[model samples]
Structures are given as C-alpha cells and as structure tokens.
Target: MTTLICTLQDHRDDVNWCAFSGNLLATCSGDKTLRVYSTSDFSELAFSPLSGHGYSVHCCCFSACGQFLASCSTDATVVIWSMVSGEIEAVLEHPGRSPVRICALSPDSVHLVSGASDGTLALWDFPSKQLCRTGTVNEATLVACSFSPCSQVFVTGSTYGDLRLWDLEMRQLHAEKNAHDLGVTCCTFAPSILSGGQVVQFRLASCGQDSQLKIWAINKFNFGGYKMHLLHTLTGQSAPVLSCAYSSDGQLLVSGSVDKTVTVYDANNALLLYTLNQHERYVTACCFSPTAPIIATGSMDKTVNIWRLEDGCRGRDGKSVPEQSALTSSEGRKKIYLPIHLCIS
Candidate 1:
C-alpha cells in the first residue's frame, strides 16, 4: 500500500526534478535553486537552497557513490558539488554556451557527461575537469541521458524520439531505434531477475509525450549479445508521461504524467498496481529512493510528495502477498486506483 507521507514546498518555482542519495532527497527547480531534505522526517536540511546557477536549474544527479552531485542549468554550465561539504567543487563550461539540459556521472564516478540542447554530448575527465570528447548521435536535441548499471554503456533519449545505446568503453553504437511517436523524455534501466535466481537481464524503460510507457529487454540471453527487444507496453495514462524510475530492487516501476497522477506497476508482470493522484499540477519528475520503497515526486504545483510501500515484496509477516484476480470498479477515469495491499496509513 502507498500513502502520502508529506508534501515539501521549498522551491519558489516549478521543481524540475528530484533525486535520492542515501537517505537525502535533492530537488532542483526553475527558480535557480537546489534543496536537500531528509527522507525520514521530510525536514529541510541545513545546506538547502544551494545557489550557484545563474539560470534555471534543469536537473541534478548524484554520483553512484553518493559522494558527489552534478547539476546542469540553462546557463550553459554544469556544477559539481561535493556531498561531503555541500559546496561547489568545480564548474564545467559547455561549448558554444548551449543550455546544458542534462548531466550524468558515469557509474565508476570517473567521468561526467553533459547533454546539451544543441544535440551534442560531451565527456569530461572528472578529476581534472577537462573536456575529453564531444560527439553527436543525431541532429535532434538529446532530452535525457543515463549510464548503465555497469557503466560500460550509456543511453540517450532525443527530442525526436531517438533512443541510442553506446558502448562507453569502445565508443561504438550497441543499438539504436525510434522508440516512441513523440520526443522521449526519460530512460531508465533496471535488472530483470529471473525466477529462482537463474539469470539477470538488463531491461530499459522509456516514456515520452505519447502517453505510453515501454519496457524493452536490452540484453538477450538467446542471442548472447546486447539487442533491444520489445517486452511490453503499459497504457492507461490520459496524458503524456514525463518521467520514470525503477525501485532499488527492481520489483516495481513508477511513472509520473502530465495528467497530475503517478502510477506504480508490478515490473515482473507489467500489472497496474497503483494509480496515485495527489499532486495538483503536472508531475514533472519522480524517482524511487536508493534503498527504500519510498517514491518521491516533484510537480509544477511547487511541491514534492513522498509515497512509501511497507514491506515492499512481502506481506506483514514475511510471507508473500497472496494474489487475487484484478478488481473492477465503476469509478472510470476520474478515480484513483490501487491494489489490495495498498494503504493510506
């Protein structure tokens, strides 16, 4: 069951995105500010509203180790902050002064990459802050970029709906495709664990303005190579889907939409597990906590909502929750829905 724990309203403008690092939640906003909060009490941290950007802060991401944070802005610069001190450690200047719409750190935390509005991707040597390489996948702007779990590959989603996977070590294309009808807004990867712990598959999830969500099996066991295969498509959203993420255990998937609703899915079977409608405006961003069952969402309504599922994979006493047939109700499109295990407490 999912319950709204609290609503955080620290930003003066629209919160662009929210990310979790350990037990702390960091949020960036159009007001050109960044804030950190404790996931436990939803209280503002001492080093909140960390201001350095001269323009709208588009996104913020934490390094895999949670020791550093990287944030990009319309000011054409990416700022790397030391999590140890909550202070800016370095500033990376983007070429051509293009808006650095998104930035992500490689999983190994050795390289920092930034995606610009002009459709270019640049890699920086994290230690020295030197531009190592810059390249373009295509002509359209890259809207989202993230590194794989192994850090050997990275994926990019374009404003033209282009999805491309590149081998970071080899600097070669692994796969490419037109993933959706509209611009792809987000792309996330999670491990697909086989039953009885046989094999682990890499899966990719993507969403966009098309009001659809897709899961793709990225690495094939049959072919013994990396190739994307359509796994399933989840629909029921009436508006464009904006963002998505997988739980730390990869047992659940969550998405936020322009329809002002957040939905959680059973990742194993692609079942609609919960539809949360608590935000008053467009849900611009959503993410799962690093080590918990909590989901955090940021909205244009200038608030952040945290929803948690207790005993995520098991029932109250450690046994698995018994499954029943899907429920049918007359609420139609106007009502929010949740599974039997869902709760408001």
Candidate 2:
C-alpha cells in the first residue's frame, strides 16, 4: 500500500469541498479562493480569487459537463463560474439575512437548487438568471441539499432532522419526514442505474450529528403513497460521519468522519472495509475518482490522501498490505492498497 500519490497545498484556510472533473480537481476554502489543480501531478492549474463571501465556503461542485463551477458560502451567496474563462458568470444572493448552507446544480446545468440557514429552499434557472420558486421548509437550519439524478426532484435535510423532497416542476412538496434522530449533516440519493430494472426502488443515504449512517429504501406502497424503510444502520465510528459518497458502480459506500478515519461498506449493511488513522484530524470531505479506483479524502490536518479501493485486501494477520510500491518513497508518506475484490461482497 502507498500513501497519497500526490498532495496539493494551496488553500491557507479550511478546505470545505473537493470535486473532480476529469483529471482536474476543484477546491473551495475559507481563504476566499477557488483553486483548480491537475490530478496527475497534483500541480496547481488555475487560481480564481473570489471575495464576495464574508464567511467560510460551505460547499462547491462542478457541473456535469465540467464547464461551470458552483459554490456556496456562509455569506449566503451562490457564485457560478465559467471554467473556461475563470470568470464569475452569475451570483445568486438571498435578500439580507439568509445564509446559504448548501447548493447543487442539476445534471442538465439549466437549474440550481440551494438551501439556506433560514430553512428556505430556492430554485434558480441558470439561463434566465432568475429565481423560479421558493418554499419554506418550516424547520431548523437547513444543512444539506441534493438534486435527484433525473433532475426533476430535489431534497433538503435540516438541522432539525427533517428531510423534505420537492418537485421542481410543480414547486410542491412531494414527501416530508423526520429521517434521523439527530440533525442531518449530509445526504445523497443513489444513482438510478444502481436500482437495476426497478425504477421505483430508490435509495437515499444520510449521516448526522448522532454519528450514525442510515440508508433508506423509498418504495411505493400498494395503492397510494410512498414509504421510506430503513435498510441499514452503520455503526462503529467514534465521531460524527461528516461526509459520504457512493462508488460509481454503486456497490461500495465510503464515509469520512471526525473519528480520523474513512470507513467503506458494501451496499448491504455489511462492513466490507475501513481505513483508520490516515488523517491526524477530522476528515471534512471525501469523493470517489471519476475514472480511477481511487478515493480522495480532505482533512482538517490540511492535506488530502488518496486511498486505492484495492487496499482492502488483508494479509494472513488480517492487516492490509501494500499491493504496489507506487507510493513508497523517501517523502515519509503512508499507503495501504487493499484488493478491490474484498469490498464487492
């Protein structure tokens, strides 16, 4: 096993989100800057300094086509940038008192959804540069928001433990429920392709301040309504699970935690694998590489570590051994490569 193959150090403040577009990586930080890096050599490619946000950047994402970058900050503004020119294309701001907590762009890049600290969710049309609709969630502060893969629906999770689904076209609430015991910090919908041939069997995963990870299967009941049933409850992390991501194949789930580790689990509730003591501090973000079998995790320790999916294979003593010498160097970095087959079950 090897440690991080590359390390990019440009953010002086807390790095909140790290996203990839092909071989390019985009990162947003409290330093009031958005940076783009080449994943091949971990070299800095472009630096766009943004100064409108008065507070820390909470989240950032790249559009599906990799042509635009969207970011939200505690200053309550969502800024959209053109990747080609590195210019701010649009700035979506709330009135005077709202603080934007999370933002997500639709797959088509025509619509954007954002949640605010005031428990309000807003939908914006990118082409028209206008707010299309707004709805009050009637809960505590909203923490996380996600758009469905189909781009027709969006969901927001609140600090009050409520998860509400909204239909973008009708601008009405489709479903609402208390999905967790503690405040939800992050939530994501599984890819539609992962459901096999069942279009209605959708899965949603959420993690909260309670340090528990829960997976729900949303299925239609006999005659009229939809029901959410808990499919799995993952335990063992000593701290809150701050972020989670599903593999492109949808067979594996990876989560970063305040416990200073990243845990990997199968689609079922089974514990397929885990990586401990990687970061010296809390892991703030994690994501699977778009093309490689790599998972990148950013930490409060001010560094990002890339772990190979093949690192889960164990030796005779039940310890994962380095499968390759690719990461062994005099730089004093650590690497663990477990075979990918161990995580498929």
Off by over 4 Å in 1: 169-172, 191-200, 220-225, 314-345
Query: How many clashing residue pairs appear in each of the predictions shown?
Result: 2, 14
Candidate 2 regions with alpha-carbon error over 4 angstroms: 1-3, 48-52, 95-97, 169-177, 194-199, 220-225, 311-345
Candidate 1 residue 288 C-alpha distance from true site, Å: 0.7
Candidate 1, residues 18-115, lDDT tens digits: the string is 99987678899999998887665666778777899999998898877787788999999999887777899999999878898888777678787788
The alpha-carbon deviation from the true structure for residue 233 of candidate 1, after best TM-score superposition, in angstroms, is 0.7
What C-alpha lDDT do the candidate models reach, one value each? 0.77, 0.69
Residue 145 displacement (Å), model 2: 1.2
Best by lDDT: 1
